[model samples]
Each structure stands twice: as C-alpha cells, then as structure tokens.
Target: MDTAPKRILLIDMDDILRRTLAEQLSAQDGLRPFPVASGEEALAHLAMHGADAALLDATLAAQGLIPALRAGGLSGPLLLLLPVGMGVPIGGDDHLTKPIRLGTLLTRLKALLNQTDTQSASAGMDDILSLGPYRFLPAAKRLETLDGTRIRLTEKETQILNHLCRRGGTAPREDILDGVWGYGAGINTHTLETHIYRLRRKLAAGQPLVMRIEGGYRLATAPVPA
Candidate 1:
C-alpha cells in the first residue's frame, strides 16, 4: 500500500464547510487538504505547491473553474461537489451530491487519484500526430496539409479531434462531450453534433475524414478500397 500523504485541494465558497472538510481530511492518515474559497486562490496555491487532486463546488464550475485549472496546467484528478438536484457539470473526474458524507468523499477521491496514477504510468501521445490527410498539431491547435495549407481550429474543435485521435476508433457521443467539453449527462449532446458537423465541412477535401457511426463518430484516416 502507498504510504505517502495525498494532497487534496478543495475550492468552495462555504467557509464553514470547507474548513470542516479540511480538518476532517487532516485527521485521516496519508491525506492532506488545501482548502480555498475561490478559483484564483486555488490557482495560486497550485502554482506555488501542487496537489494530488482537487475538489470544486459545482457553483464554481459554472464560472469556468475547471477549464481554468486545466489551462493553468493542473492535470491531476478533479472532482465536483454538486448541490442536490443540480445537473452534472462539465469537466471533472467524478462528482458527489451535496451534504457530502466524509466517508463517501474520501472513497471517491481515493478512487480518482488511483486511476490517475495508473494512467500516468502508461504511455501518452506525442504532440504531433497524423490525422487523415493532415498533420495534426494538438499543441499548436492547428492542422497542416502536405502542400503547406494550414487550418486553424477552435479550442473545442482541437480538443474534439485530439480525443478522437487518441481513441483510435468510434467514440460515443456522451463520452466525447465529457472528454472534449467536460460536459456530462444532461448537457445537450447537440453541442458535440454541431462541432462534428463543422469539422466534417472543414476536413472535406476529397473523401470523408470524420464519419458518424451508429453510436458515435470515428476518424477515417484513409479511403476504403474501391
């Protein structure tokens, strides 16, 4: 068993609750909690000293906290504390309903962190990759054709393609939204469909590159033989 202390960052506006959670976490063996009231404070803390995972209030999620943390370079596990009856927010490793029990919180947090550790030990994709007839550059958020043509992609578009390329096969609509837009169940799937439509139009050169399968979508790297 891993004996190292796990540092967890908690972002919530509720001072009493946040402090209570922090204290509870501190009492546990091999657990450390860094509680903050706002996204700015959370980012600052991460910049100075990183945590193993982060938990955010669902209210803060609507204000773009998740994407901000990701843009700030926090690749660690992120969990959302949702209020009762609230729809699931976009972009988190996992979520729990409010009036959260300490036992449940700890259980979910531990699972997400463990998953992160396992994924980290595996191989990751390179910055540059080939997608269909273009050389995909995820970092640059652009694609290049052989003859020197370049296509700029929106951040969402780039994320969509990056995810599809990583899957190496058809990706379910719900999974694509969760992975690409950080949106989970109840969020409109039309957002993903619209992006796919635009991507198909942009990538239409001579053959269809992005194809819609029965369940989801896939990247067709080459045309099928006649």
Candidate 2:
C-alpha cells in the first residue's frame, strides 16, 4: 500500500517560482506541495488544514509573516526561500538562498521530515501527556485545551515536551538540548529557547504550563483544570 505523501505548504508571490517549485516537488515521490500566492491565503489554508512543513518566500519574511503564521496555528517547520544577498535573518526552522537547486531543496525537506518521523515513531502510542490544563499527544504532535480547542505542535516542541515528560516533569537545559536536538553538551544556541517561547505562547495562554527551574525547565505535574 502506498502511504500518503508529506504535505508541504509553498508560499510565494512569484507565479513562475511557485509553479516551477510545485512541479518539481510533485515529481518527487512521497511529497506534495500546496502553493499559495499570498500570506493571507496561506494563513487561511493553514487554519483549515495544516501542512507537514511550510516553504515561504523571503518577501513574506520581510512582512513578518512567521509570527502571524504561528499565531494563526501553523506549528510546522518553516523554511524561507531568500533571493541572493538577502541578509536579513528570518524566524523559521531553516532558510535557503536562491538560486536554489531542486535537489538541495528536496534534501533539506526530507531531512526535516525525517527528523520528525524518527521522533514520532519513538514517541510510541498516542498516549496523552497531561500538563496543567493541556493534554499533549506526542506521537500525534497535538495538544488539547480544557476548552476543547486543539493545537498542533511543531516537531521540536513535541520532542521537548516528550523529553520533559520522561524526566518526571523537569529536566536540565543540557539534557534537553542533547535529547531533543542531539547536540553535545556546551553547544550554544538560542533556537531551543525560541521554540520554548513560541510553545508557551501557543499552549499556555494566560496560565503557564512550563516553568523555568534553577538550571532547566519543568512541566506542571498536576492538572490545573480550566
């Protein structure tokens, strides 16, 4: 049986680029690209049907669409496509500067998806991990609120939560980085902190579920019902 292809959201204003990339992605097995011309349309589509990953144009990054997408419930890994000499750093999981080779793009996309796939498989069954008023299913990369709203989690977010859950609701910073990112001790990067901030914004709302400890972070053990 053929499994469904991974869905990739492609947002680019350039018609030629969008069509060309979409065709290239479609030609590859196990991949599907849904192209959109504007951030508004992309946001709408994401709200209704989320994708596995998103490829956004640099113009959208300039317009600060990354935060908007996160606020609008896009929890996938985002990759920004930049034109030559676009030096501004974008808030995304990754970025590629044009002129990009299709093979390079495919390799990057597959790496991102494979990372998530490995973690998801290791997450085991769709068991719910409760944190305060939120319930998270690591395998599904999903979180459910007490009010019944469902929020999807980015792959990294899910991995972080799973790591904390396995460590009795609290874990050291170094341990988290090593477990979730496969980074060696003493590796320095703000990426983990950034993802934590975004996850708190999405999952916590007014009530915080993740708390900072002396040398790490902790998840609330008792369920704080809404």
Candidate 3:
C-alpha cells in the first residue's frame, strides 16, 4: 500500500476547478491537496489548520483579499491562478494563466513547494539553510533545537527561517522580502519579524539562535544550551 500524500490547501471558488486541480495533485508522491471555496475559509484553515502551500485565484472579487490573507500570516509560496486581463500581484510568489492544464499546474505547484532545489520537490531547501547553531532541513520542514529536539515547522515558518539563515548573519530586509516572500520589490521585512517571534517562542529564548539587528535582522552564531 502507498503512503498518504502531503497536505496542501487549494483555495478556489469554482467547484470544477477545485476538483480538477485536487485530482492532479493527488497523483504526486507525498502530495495531498485540500480544496476550499471561499477566501475566508481557506485562510482560516491556513492559520489554524495549516497547509504546505496555497493556490489562490487572482480574480477573487473581495477587495484587498490577497493582501488581507497574507497579513493574516501567510508564509508559504502562493500561486495566483490568473484571471482574464488580470496580471499577477506584486507580492505573489508566482502565477499561472488559467485554462486548467494538469501538467502545468503540477509543475508550477511542485516548484512552489520546492524552491531553487531542482532535484525533487520533496528535496527541501533545508540542507542549504543554517541559522544560529542549527541547520534547517527544508526538505523535511523540521528544525532541530541545539538540545536535539526536532520541531516540525509549517511551510511559511520554514521559508522565513530559511531567509534568516541564508543571510549568513546579514539578512537584508529587501533580500528577505524578495527571496523568502517572493516579492521582487516593495520589500518590507517587519513581516519577517512577526514570524521570527513565533518561531523563537517555540524554540525558546535561552537557545540563543535568532536575533534582531540594525539595517534589518541577522542570524548569528548561537551557543547551544548548557
């Protein structure tokens, strides 16, 4: 018997579009796509229930809907399923013009979950990121405390942590916004701080892993707990 697919959240209004996308993603290894109709319910689950990634329709009529959802703390790579005559959003990680092609959707979705790492979507960016005294395994989405407790992190939390780690102690606000959040411009890293707070709380302060600094934030070498 095969194992269950990784949980994914699909936020789209159209029933047909939702089902079709879910079916295609279901075929991938360790990839499960959960379907939701409205933006509210979709975001609610993301904050409370959690998802590996999110797919949103650019045509959502609710004003300020995308930004609102993001402000509510969306850290995962977001793909805007574009609408007729509408271009992609400035802050969205990626986008695709829609005609409901399965192959293309899978390719895009895979890329969203896996960034820059070309081998396999499951091959997370983890091995590449190191913050404080810990090396983050992005592929596994797990953070190992200095004391050796392996704490699982959500996709966005991992992404935020990766940006901090990749900084090598000089994490620039602009770079973090563009690199981690996928915004090429309008770089605001205060959002990054919010995420770091939650992560620090989970990992604990005495751990001495993450910290703030001038000119943005920096991930420094931290000592493991004694």
Candidate 4:
C-alpha cells in the first residue's frame, strides 16, 4: 500500500505457464510476479529481493518453498497453498491447484497481501520496533536497542510483538491472550500475563510505554507523521 502496487512471487517450472501467469497478474493487477523455474530460484529471489505475497507450486523441484519460507520471513496466514496435490511439502501463502479458479486465486491473493500491508503499516506507527536507535525491521525480524545493542528475537517473540504492534491501540487482553496463545491452551492457563510481562521486559525498551490500554497491551505511540 505504501504508494507501491502489491508485489507477488509466482513460481512455475513450466516456462509457458510461468510467463502467462506472471503476465496475467502483473499486467492485469500491477502485481509483480518474480516467476522462476525452480524452488531454489524462488529462495534466491527471496534472499535478494522479497515480495509481498508468494505463489509457490506444491510440486516445485526439490526442497519445496516451505523450508525457504521458514528461513526467510515470507510466512503469513495466507502462506500455504497446495495446488496440484502432488503431496509434496508446499507452504507460504495459501495454494490452489493446477487448474485453479482464476478469480478465486486472485481474490485470496489480494486479501492476504492487503492484510499484510495493513498490519505492517499499523506496526510502523505504534512501535519503535526492534532497534532503539536504528528503529525496527519487521520483515527482517531484527531489533536494535537505543544504546546500540542488537537483540535478535526468536520467531515466536517476533510474531507476538507483531501481533501486539499491529493491533495499534487498545487490544483487549482476551484478544491478545487468545492470539498469543491458542484458544486450546488458553482455556486453562495463567501464562498470558507472564508472557506479556516477559515481552514487555524484552521489547518495550523504555520507549515511554509500549502498551497504552490498562486492560491489556497494544502497541501505543504518539503518532506517525503524515
């Protein structure tokens, strides 16, 4: 959304299909698809240039997209599509099938990318992020403290922080509690407060306050400049 059209990473080993799909998405919707022939190519592309959403074929040659996605931060709810039912491991952004309904695929892709963009922008305004001096990098999952110290948080911590930060202001405790910990475990647990306290200690970084609402915690900051 940042004045930039959404980007897509569409992978298809078939040359003709790759070109056709990429062109369709790019030309029709202005979604840039970094089409590649192999899963490795997708990984390489991600290593160098990342995209807002990824469309990985379930049958991509070797190692699949899941492993690479786990390494990189290309994961979101929409990050797991299984088109073709080859039964091979495929993940990161929902998948469809070999003969997918074009409209449905595009709709799902747009919704996912839109959600990611919204969350990212919300996080930007409400939190100082990782680094104290250098600011934060959500995509990279790295944080730097004010005194020039680096703190590399685990995937879990980063995800939890992202959830709170994206909530903007005033996320209810029950909501956060359910989000951070699944409803299954949350039903009989007092761990929510403990985790929040721990997250606060590690991520807050004396930024005045990371949570504004007393009932619960939400990434709270004055406001970003227009």
Candidate 5:
C-alpha cells in the first residue's frame, strides 16, 4: 500500500470549524490538511500549492471560490460543507452538512483519494519521468537524484516540470501557463516566472536542468547514465 499522505485543502470562515477539521484530519495517518480562513486565502494557496482534495464551506459560495477553483486549474475532488438546512450545490464532488461526523468525512476523503489514484494509474501517469540525473514523480510530487537524495518540490514546481516533460521537454510561455495555471495566452501574471526562479534555485546543484528558451522553458533532455 502507498503510505504517502494526501494533502487536503481546508477552507472555512469559522475559525473553530477550520481548526477542528484541520486537527482531526491531521490526526489521520494518511491525511494532512492545509487550513485557510477565507476564500481569498484559499484561492491564493490553491493557485500556488495544489492539493489532492479540497474541503470548502458553503458560506464561501458568496465569495465564488468554487468557480475560482476551476479557473485556477484545480482538478481535484472537492467536498462542500453546508450549513444546517442548506441544500447541496452542484459544484462539489461530495458534500456534508454542518454538524459533520469526523468518521464520515474520513471515509469520503479516503474514497476520493482511492478513486484519484486508480484514475491516475489507468491514465499511465504513475510512472516516474527522468530529468537528467533526477527522477521526477508527478503523481507523488517528488524529485530525487541518482545518489538517493530526495528533493522537495512545491506544487507549482512539480506542475511546471510535469508540463514541460509532457511537451517533449519544451513548452512556450503561453502554452505552459495554459497547461499549468489554466490561464489564457493574453492574461499576464508573474506567478509563473516567480515559481520558475524559485525552482531553479532549488535545483541549482543539479545539472543545468531547467533552461529558458526564446519564449519559454525546457528540461534537460540529455540521457543520464543509470
């Protein structure tokens, strides 16, 4: 069995509810919750750090977080927490009303993660891709060197590298943004550049792994000896 913990994004305006859910979820062996208090914070976090699943409060519907999440290219399972007497909305993959049972929540999350893993395997995305001397595992969001040194990758860094790898190790700027951030060609955001800069810093000791071409980025494709 894969022992990797699934990262869950927990969003709620109620401080007590957010803290409680975060604590309970973290106590689970295979779950880790990244809690945020408001829709804005949630959106920002999701934009930079993708989650395996999300738990959102229905109260944030007024803030339009659901639509924003889609626009931000978060393709993970979403669970909406509704207030008492509230009807379920059409957006989330699953939902639970207020006064939620922790056991039920855990079951739902585990099911969702299992479904995602099966889908990923069927799609042939479970294999690791080689990047020079490093091994890049997209589904696991992990990078490791030939010497067995593991390197931590932020969500954005992993997404960027994965996109580049899929595109034959090179992708134009607009195409990369579209693939990774779901942003259109004309939309301007420095977020991609910032992530690339930081990622380069993290990979500094590795061979010139990521490089900027005329219009975008590419990974070093030269074969590495096993």
Candidate 6:
C-alpha cells in the first residue's frame, strides 16, 4: 500500500505562526504541510497540487476565501483557527481557538481526516458511479447495465475503473498506476496494460469506450451519476 504522508495546506497571513506550524507539522510522522501567506497563494497551489485537508486562519474566511477554494475544486476538510471568544464560523468543518494548542490541532485535524475517510468508504459502498451506459459499484466490484445486468469485476479492475472515472474519465497512466496499485507495489506499465486489456474486454460496450491517448488513457465519455 502507498503509505505516503497526508498533505495539509496551511493558510495564514502571520508569517511567523505559519512557518512555525508548517515546521511542526512537517516533523510529524504522516503529515506534510504546505504553508501559504495568503488565500491567493493557497488557491494557486491547490489548482496545481491538491491537499488532503486545509488549515485556514479565520480572518481569511472573512475575506471570501472559503467559497473561492470550493469554486476552485478543493474538496478537502477545512479546519479554521478562530480568534478566542469567536463562535464557529460558516465554512469550516471544525475549528480551533487561536494561540493554537499543537496537540489539540493535531487531534482535531486527524479526527476530521478520519471522518472523511469513513464517509468516503461509505459513499463507495452506496454510490453507483456512472460512466457511459454502466453503473459502477466500486465496493462491490461490480457493474450494472441499463437493463440491470450485473458484471462482476476483479478488485484491480474495479480500482482501475474507479480511478479513471474519478479523474474526469482521463488520467495519465503513471497517476492511475500510483493511485490504484500504490507507488511501491513493484507494478509496472506492463501490469497496467494487462489490467486495461482485461477491463476493456469486460466492459463490452461497443464503439471503443476506452482508448489509449497520447501519454495517457481516456474514456470516450465523461463520468456521471446514473
């Protein structure tokens, strides 16, 4: 399994505090922190490289940063650092009083991440992800046709399909490999190709539904809910 560190985006205008928090988070076992001086910087970073969660200074929320991040496609849990005596704000998943207690921050952040993980697992079990004419039940490793015919998928086949579907129906092969098979699984392009071949054979949808693109692969149509 890929045991890479979870990325946390730390947004704060206080250079001293941001740097200190970033340093502290970096020292933790499974966290990698990216500290930004402003909301604009945070958005730019998020557009290019996504974060698993965010830690935002509450003052920035007053400036409309929360909606902007959401509009920019950041779907991570956001933890707000509020000034003492302030009530919970509008857009944060959770909050911590300023003059932050490091222990408390870690605890709350981890809890939020865990909650997100649990929710995602639940969604995978229940949500029928759609791509073209099929409904994909990832947790069950099965696909359903419009007529309710079920096609059993291997675990790896399900992972590959889900990965492609999540990436808007097109993803670089390297990213798909890392996402589905883990970075250090000793799996290679040949392994991926073999899986892709099997998956295509099983999909059985006419019109070349899955195709090899330049430097990547693409689905003929985008993913959608059935």
> Residue 206 CA error for candidate 4 (Å)?
31
Candidate 4 C-alpha lDDT tens digits along 142-207: 566557666554333454566665565346666754554333323544444544555567656455
Show the colliding residue pairs in model 5. none
Q: Candidate 2: where are CA atoms >4 Å away?
A: 88-90, 124-226
Q: Estimate, for each residue in 81-110, the C-alpha lDDT of model 6 and write its tens digit.
A: 987887544556556788998997897787
Q: Which residues of candidate 6, in runs, are more than 4 Å off?
A: 123-226
Instruction: Name the candidate, 4 or 5, with the larger lDDT value.
Output: 5
Clashing residue pairs, candidate 1? Answer: 90-182, 91-182
All candidates: CA RMSD (Å): 7.1, 5.8, 9.7, 9.3, 13.2, 15.7
User: Which parts of model 3 are misplaced by more than 4 Å?
Assistant: 1-5, 116-226
- Candidate 1 global CA lDDT score: 0.74
Where does candidate 5 stray beyond 4 Å? 1-3, 123-226
Which runs of model 4 end up more than 4 angstroms from their true locations? 61-64, 70-83, 86-91, 123-226
Cα lDDT over the full model 4: 0.56
Name the lDDT value of residue 207 in candidate 1: 52
| CA lDDT, candidate 4, residue 84 | 57
On TM-score, the stronger of 2 and 3 is 2
Worst 10 residues of 1 by lDDT: 117-126
Task: Kindly list the per-residue Cα lDDT of model 1 for residues 1-226, writing each as its tens digit.
Answer: 5677988999999999899999999999888999999999999998888878888999999888888887776767787899889976666656788998999788667756654554334233236776656777755657778777987654456666777776775688777866654556566436577666776677777456578888788888731211
Comparing 3 and 4 on TM-score, the stronger one: 4
Model 6 error, position 198 (Å): 47
Model 3: how far residue 151 lies from native, Å: 28
Question: Could you give me the TM-score of model 5 versus the true structure?
Answer: 0.53
CA deviation > 4 Å runs, candidate 1: 1-3, 124-226
**Best of the candidates, lDDT:** 2
Query: For residues 1-226, could you state the per-residue lDDT of candidate 2 as single tens digits?
Result: 3378988999999899999999999999999999999999998998898888889998887898888887887666777899898854445765678887998788667766765666666644266767766777776677887888888776677788887887778899989877765556797666578878887778555467778889899986742222
Lowest summed lDDT window (length 10), candidate 5: 115-124
| TM-scores of the candidates in the order shown | 0.59, 0.58, 0.50, 0.50, 0.53, 0.55
